[model samples]
Target: MSAENEVRQFIVAADDDGIRLDRWFKRHLEDVSFNIVSRWARTGQLRVDGARATPGDRLVQGQTIRVPPAEPVKPDTVKVKPDRPPLSDDQIAFMREMVIHQDASAIVLNKPPGLATQGGTKTHEHIDGLLDALQFDLEGRPKLVHRLDKDTSGALLIARTSRAAAFFSKSFSGRTAKKIYWALVMGVPEIEDGIIDLPLAKQPGTGGEKMHVDEKEGAPSRTRYRVIEAAGNKTAWVELQPFTGRTHQLRVHMAAIGHPIVGDGKYGLQEAFLTGGISRKMHLHARRIRIDHPDGGKLDATAELPSHFAESMKTLGFDLSLGDWIPLDDGPVPPTREQKKAMGRAHAKSVRKERRGERGRRRG
Candidate 1:
């Protein structure tokens, strides 16, 4: 430990009362690794309420925890490097062109479809790797506060500073941030406007890439949707507002309700692709986001539909003018913290039940 570093004490917040000790460390002291936490616990260096604590030990509200000083990691010991090479001139220019809004606190990009927000296996090009191009002459590199799917095009927010990033992150995780999406589904829903309250879980055996509707073992997911226009029940332009963020929540929810977004092969199946000269790109777009800004006023931005989505709308005879209209009222109020906790508990119970069932099946 460096001379500047000292032992730190923390009081468990009400919101984190029942969370595991290791999870608490990950949330508050993100730089501390699980290995370090484990080592400390084994060596009696970590304590809660003046006693040794375990990684899985649940913390209580107002409990006192003593955290030891973290040793500064030497530069030579760092192993991981930037995943991809620096952006080329053309890549830089392309990124610059995507900027729809930029200010001291944030930058909003009209992210195009077919572009991944961050890189993964087999993914070379992504917004994260190309963000250097957006720097211009700014002092600090911009950071992504949220993410959209690879095929989802639209308003992607990038925080300009670390403070701004932390602020936006809190806003999002606290459910104060509001996002609206525009998607063209293959079939028109029977109801013009309604809410989908479906629980979502990773599909078994998918290696965590795909989501499925699993009421028994899934997290609470809700989406409010209104149909803007429909072409004789064949296809509809729908506006979606997700109340709870989940992996592929909108896509899986729509598909679970029997109206998958067009061109979504992973969730929707073959019928999702429209024939007859319509572009076979996913039609989901993150249309708008409204949130409290770090600098006092509201931060809001809207992204125009990608060219393919626009063409599809025109072909389906849906009016494009409706996209400009913002909802008169703040959409749905986010759930209370207690309600969120209850939902989380239900999901965890379901997961445990599922694991037991799987074990029984294996034994049989």
Candidate 2:
């Protein structure tokens, strides 16, 4: 065996106590790729406190992690890439202009439409790339805690530190964060206020880019929408609150009820367009976001509408003052696991009672 063939051991620190084993590797062993870590776990070479552990296993403080010897690098295995080009003055100015709110731990941007939150294939100019300019006074670049669609505009939050990122991520996952969205739908709903309680699954053949209502096999999704104003039954301005963070939940829920957001051709088809010079861009905007601050208190921010959206509202003659103050409801809350189990038992009991009643009626 080579000199480097000896195993290495690490003790989990308090800061990394609850982090996954793979994440610990990334933080400390930057040269150790994820694939190597997975292979070590699969071959029983990776362990925590003398027990075979997976990459996803959470580490506890003072736990010993046994790691196999570093794999030797092969010829042409490592690729050296150039560093990112420095941001131009214009780019830095634009990114700074997007900031609507900033605190020690968080920064909120009034992200405009057409700029993606993160880059994908063929997408080069994105908010993620511009985050470097927002890193003012911070050693690390701010991290995105949530996302908004490329066509949707409005309040997007960024965490200035890793601790803030973890805190904001937990707040969103716990559903304690409140997000209010505004959208102009194709038609006015008969009910001014209602909840869309449909289950959603990715539409087959769309490559998971589109969502549709699925009854038998789908994740539970719920959205509460209230019509703020209507223009002669042709269109309505609505406020949307999603209880579950499904992909495109607000867009899918609105479309499923036959009132797709204006200009959403993917889901609404030709009917998504309006003829009265309304902007062809998607009309959904995240109007406001409120969440618990990492330090204390609450961080609440409101983003102004994009120019196109503001113009459309002016054309519709809907007062801007009326838009932001709509009373929010308690909204749809997901059932807890214990509540679901109790409901299941109650449903089975009802079924048994009905069966017994059927037998009694036959005897009569």
Candidate 3:
């Protein structure tokens, strides 16, 4: 986080779940201090649904809040600079180019891991704030149709106008958007492929700064995953397609099944995030996407996994790529013939055991 005074943005999480306004911002905002948050609200720096709100106001879900910056004491005299350049021209240029496809209606961006899709007061240099650097015609201010976790790189759609935003929002709300993620979980699935249908309600942490799984009252979430490449000794290259998008749903769900994506801070093995294990980045990527285009058709987008991810893939014994799509007839390159054969053998044994048990019951 540099000392730049960049314009910030934030998303209001609804209060229906009983989250407090001040508390929420304190947790969500980066570079934002608690005292500053309080003063901003007192001075009407906070707005709810475009209206001012009190610090104690209970959050209503689905409301958007905006917190304006504080007036500088020595407005013109003080400029905060960072110790080091936050993002280089080459990096910014790289980011702009990652935007694979954009139209007057929508933008398909390959978001890098470690960058927030949107922004908050504490958030500096996020994808939302960098849109101006892009060489596209965003008819007006573009809004993120969805988000990827800071450490997860992948394709995300941005609506360029309010109308387009509304269109994308509706599509997401209706569960028509198809999102695919690639996770380098540190274990193989019990089955070759399966769907995890579990409800996820966010469980608050002791410090109220982290999240966990609470199945008793969790929201409905589902994920379909297949082992694309087995990296041996409890690790695999898995392709995940989430049906219901819950925050950290994919990561948590994978962990629940005895597999967690390597380098996932909250829901993963600590060894994977340590200095020696993985350099500095997480091993989760939003690989490809298929969504309804605002203009009439489908938009397919892909993002090559970042350098850190590619390196991990090599170390983990997975030389896969998000290259051109793999066709059905395409032979065993990733989940090669030997691996498929082994899985088939395992499945056949399970089926044979089940049939024998059924016969024994009939004989009895």
Query: Order of candidates by lDDT, top first?
Result: 2, 1, 3
Cα TM-score per model = 0.74, 0.83, 0.61
- lDDT of candidate 2 at residue 185, scale 0 to 100: 97
Write the number of the candidate with greater TM-score, choosing between 1 and 2: 2
Best by lDDT: 2
Most accurate candidate by TM-score: 2
Q: Candidate 2, 247: how far from true, in Å?
A: 2.4
Candidate 2 lDDT tens digits, 60-158:
879999999988877587756578789999999999999999988999999999999999988999999989999899788889999999999999999
State the lDDT of candidate 3 residue by residue for 1-364, as single tens digits.
Answer: 4324544556653212245676666556544556777787778767887787876786665777776753345556544655533556876687678778877677788777888877765887688767655535543556677888777887888877655665677778877776678777776777967777766765764453344666677676777888888866557888887777788889888887878788876777673453435555678888877777757998777778888888877776676753234322112223423456899999999999999999999999
Task: Report clash pairs, candidate 2.
Answer: none
Query: Comparing candidate 2 with candidate 3, which one achieves the higher TM-score?
Result: 2
Distance from true position, residue 234, model 3, in Å? Answer: 3.3
By TM-score rank, best first, the candidates go 2, 1, 3
